[model samples]
Target: MSTTTLTPKITMAQAINTALRDAMTADDRVVVFGEDVGPLGGVFRVTDGLTASFGEDRCFDTPLAESGIVGMAIGMAMNGMRPVIEMQFDAFAFPAFEQIVSHVAKMANRTRGKVRLPMVIRVPYAGGVGGVEHHCDSSEAYYAHTPGLLVVTPATNADAYGLLRAAIDSPDPVIFLEPKKQYFSKEEVDVTAPVPPIGRAVVRREGRDATLITYGPSVPVALAAAEQAAAEGRDVGVVDVRSIVPFDDETVCAAVRATGRAVVVAEAPGFASVASEIAARVTERCFHHLEAPVRRVTGFDIPFPAPKLERHQLPGVDRILDAVDDLQWEES
Candidate 1:
């Protein structure tokens, strides 16, 4: 069915909440549970009003145990229920790492197709909220590394609604990482509109000089840099890779090849990150089309810094433009 409904402007968090309410209303088997998800509506209030609307069975709270939350969700999925479990914070999810990596991720394959774990694990991630240690880690690479998980992160309000809906309905387990930084960022979104497929990347802007490949929270930064580049007479394109696990290489490589230069950006540290994988793939596929080596604008290789120090650690407009500036000096 077409998910086409015109709606007023809204924030990413609001779009997500709409998706959850819709999912619960559409399917009785669908359920949501996490710490404070019922009463507090989650730390960000993304699940706010769900309990009042869907009642305790559909929208409820779990113990403060991450592992138990995931493990129980896995069991529920196997028993013919679709469970959407939330991990309150990014770092807080690590406590359930064993269940995720060992069980939830491999359940389908482990049962040799006899079982399907249709579950969604939601995590609020990344810095910019002035959050403490466990609150702002970009742990996407860890889930992307797992074999059986479908990892997705949405940058805009529309994608947030569409992708969250898609994730809840997916036959496999999904790690839906919500960029905390972009939660309050607003846009006009139609919750009923047809959403793009889960893994396809979208080119937010077009250009001829260079392409800025980014996803999640860093998408806005890349787009801002592109605008700045345009003012300086440089045509810089921007691609939002909405999904991390499937990693849209075709769209990204095509954009880079057309521009002949590319910069991959991510808030995660540079060492072995999603940005690194993007750089490698673009280089391999668009090797002959490239005029310069692929560059990455990412967080530092150290731990997530203190709140006040994040501005310097995270990639910004200047950092992205600097990478683009480097591309100009390279020979064709």
Candidate 2:
């Protein structure tokens, strides 16, 4: 919650690593458990050094069973422990969905204020890594649609660090999704930086021509396209919707109204995707302000493509610029 700028030298994955380390150090009750998280440091190495620093009890690896991972986490939370469970990939999270829905999500209310579940479930989702169907899946909607689940995603290292910390400390269960493809993407992350609170959107860029709304992996592409749009004499505003469950409609509505056009982007499939909800809600509230229809620039409805053609499959700078080109706007 403090804001002092440190040199930006960490990757998004590294920021997440530091965040988890800080959280564990701050709270003795905080326990990080996942498959291969101990000696293995997780499949993505986000938990690389925890076991050495905090010992095996605080940060340890778990069995391969998803249900067991989730069930054990819930038990630990009920007994006054803060558990952060990491699902290796989006696809592997499905096996634990039942446990999440039946127990972890409802433990607090179901017990009538007698028990609280303070746990964060982190899963790496969305297409673009040329991963298999499950590995690259964007299952935010699935969790968001479930009652009592707080779903939040970060498109940058800063948001990833702060938001994950918030999720870990919250009383309710949180579904924390990371864009695996963005793991290596570098950005200026000051370890001593102040992060915006939960359920907020960050306006990455300002413009008057059109609004590009996205989160997670597509945020960088949208920003790149906004820059390219400037060369074509177009003004584009980019809003990174960091929190998904309790969405930040104010920022998105304001940006779209000012621009009179909007393009919602994501790597998830177009049909019933989270991007669709953003487009639909914006179009509804900003109908009078919109000049052209609010269109979506998202991944194809098919499964994730091979690495060779992933750039074509997922939304990119060119694709975002093309959508911007289609929007109606006044030029000098």
Candidate 3:
């Protein structure tokens, strides 16, 4: 007799919810709170069923004040509590910039390690969700540029579960950027399974012609571009950059060196953005092995546009493919 063990399939949002539930169950110190996170279950419903499962004391709601919410989390962290707070949307987090950069990001160093903030700031980020202004934004570059903060963004459902669990358990503060567009994307996931430690980049596809390095919302676009390139007789690889800060130099450089060509993709603008940093690193580390200058396919340098116009602002498959083609290729 043959038996089939079926693995449950779930969306990224559900996977994240499962992670939160598990974390709260394991540790009494793990508390979750933010705007509408309690009774409303969050805007994307990623925190759904938390209040019922963990109760109001562990998973409650906060006011609309982003700064106050983060400030409270910092105080809670300093007092030995692990607070996982949410910023309802990407641009909505800007109001808490002072609190994040001033206190949350610098508290440990300022205290000479006497106080550690084991906190996770979850920001639902990136475009392609047709959200109005202040609803969608690619703000990873801002947090990644700051020191003393671990910045990570997951592109897959399995990662959505694992990364959040790791972030909650971390001793330092972590900026967890969730790709808003991928929240509903489903896949088979085992929430209890082990995952790679934070800061490791995973190669999604293998190719010899060129490589597409990307993260978050742009990851799917990069993979689709790779598939299209394969149809055109051009083999292309893809690297999913799960962690922004503490970048995986070894893995990223290795993939670029193997292909000898690379294009960095992101929904953020190219000017001095995360995509720019990746392109620079690839160029510097893989210079001798590179056949052409690193290219970037990124969102235009402008404010997050209206919902109807986000398509042009977010990186897409065609733009990524064009960047791949720009990589100088020798005649076959």
Roughly what TM-score does model 3 have, to 2 decimal places?
0.97
How many residue pairs clash in all the candidates, one count each? 4, 0, 0
Which lDDT value does model 1 have at 118?
Answer: 93
Candidate 2 lDDT over 1-332, as tens digits, reads: 33357655688889889889999999999999889999888888999999999999999988899999999999999889999989999988999989998887788788997888899999988777777545677788788778788889999888889898888888888899999988888877766665567788889999888899999888888988988989888888999999898889998898888988899998888898888899899988999998988989988888677566777788889888878877765432
TM-score of each prediction: 0.97, 0.94, 0.97
Ranking of all predicted structures according to lDDT, beginning with the best and ending with the worst: 1, 3, 2
Per-residue CA lDDT of candidate 3, range 92-136, in tens?
999999999999989999999999899999999988788876888
Off by over 4 Å in 3: 1-7
Tell me the TM-score of model 1: 0.97
Off by over 4 Å in 2: 1-4, 330-332
Candidate 2 or 3, higher lDDT?
3
Best candidate (score: lDDT) = 1
Tens-digit lDDT track for model 1 on 112-183? 988989999999999889997767899999999899999999999999999999999899999999999888
Candidate 1: list runs displaced more than 4 Å: 1-5, 328-332
Give Cα-based local distance difference scores for all models.
Answer: 0.91, 0.86, 0.90
Clash pairs for candidate 3:
none
lDDT of 2 at 99: 95
